[model samples]
Target: MGIGGGVFLGPVLLLIGFASPKNIAGICSAFVLVNSVVGLLSHSLQGRVDLSVLFFLGLVVFAGAQVGSFLGTRKFSPLLLQRIFAFILLAVSLKLGIGISG
Candidate 1:
């Protein structure tokens, strides 16, 4: 399911009586970390991982995540964050569907 698993997870958590948004967010973060590690290992075993590419991507992603977290904590509304995430998901889906590449 790749990262799209979040589309399932968030709703499932809500339906299962975890109505607290903060708890859901924590669960999602943990899920992401675990999934990322698993994905990385799987790709590495298949000789699909390029360390240099992964390093640069990881650095940029980490920096962006930190900035995003700061904004989320300090000023951004939850609705805004949700909309931003939705847009990102849409764009990713479009790119994949269209077989777009850099």
Candidate 2:
């Protein structure tokens, strides 16, 4: 299911009596990193990569991730983080469901 695994994983963890959100978050990050690298390598081998676009987007994402990691390390509310992740999952679901039809 590729990245869609997260959509299932978070809830399953919660349902299985895992109350620690931080552990889930850490696991998700590790999952993302491993999957993204695998995807990137596959795409690159298929000559689907545009290095310029990749560089620019990577720079933006890296900076944003640094800021987010910093904030996440601070004493913010866990509920707020969960709410934000839920919104992100919802948006991604909608986008994927609404494919362009010819």
Candidate 3:
């Protein structure tokens, strides 16, 4: 699965230079969470959701989000977080470019 919000939000948020990497990450996470909820609801209303997969995936993502939040807030430095975001943006761009080319 792909990261939904970061591709659009990350670069712009970084460019805006929020108070801290932690704050930026938190904002992105909030956006993504809201986006996911809305998507899930819309798909579910349309009778497109797979309950089994959603249950399993939700559990995994919940755990992952917790860990990532902890790490982003506690373990990584601001500079390191910035670099990580940059790298992720670069990687996503390259992947999209390659996919389009192919």
The candidate that achieves the highest lDDT relative to the unseen native structure: 3
Q: Which candidate leads the pack in TM-score?
A: 3
Instruction: Pull out the clashing pairs in model 3.
Output: none
lDDT, model 3, position 78: 88
lDDT minimum window of 10 residues, candidate 3? 1-10
Listed in order, each prediction's TM-score against the native is 0.65, 0.74, 0.84
Ranking by lDDT: 3, 2, 1
The global C-alpha lDDT for each of the candidates, from Candidate 1 onward, is 0.72, 0.76, 0.81
TM-score of 3: 0.84
Candidate 3 lDDT over residue span 31-96, tens digit each: 988888888898899999999798899899989999998988889898899899889878879988
- Report clash pairs, candidate 1: none
| Per-residue lDDT of candidate 2, residues 1-102 (tens digit) | 245376667767867967666677767777777778888899899999889799899999899878878777685588888787778777777877895311
What's the residue-level lDDT of 33 in candidate 1? 74
Give me the runs in candidate 2 sitting further than 4 Å from their true place: 1-4, 89-102
For residue 46, model 3's alpha carbon misses the true position, in angstroms, by 1.2
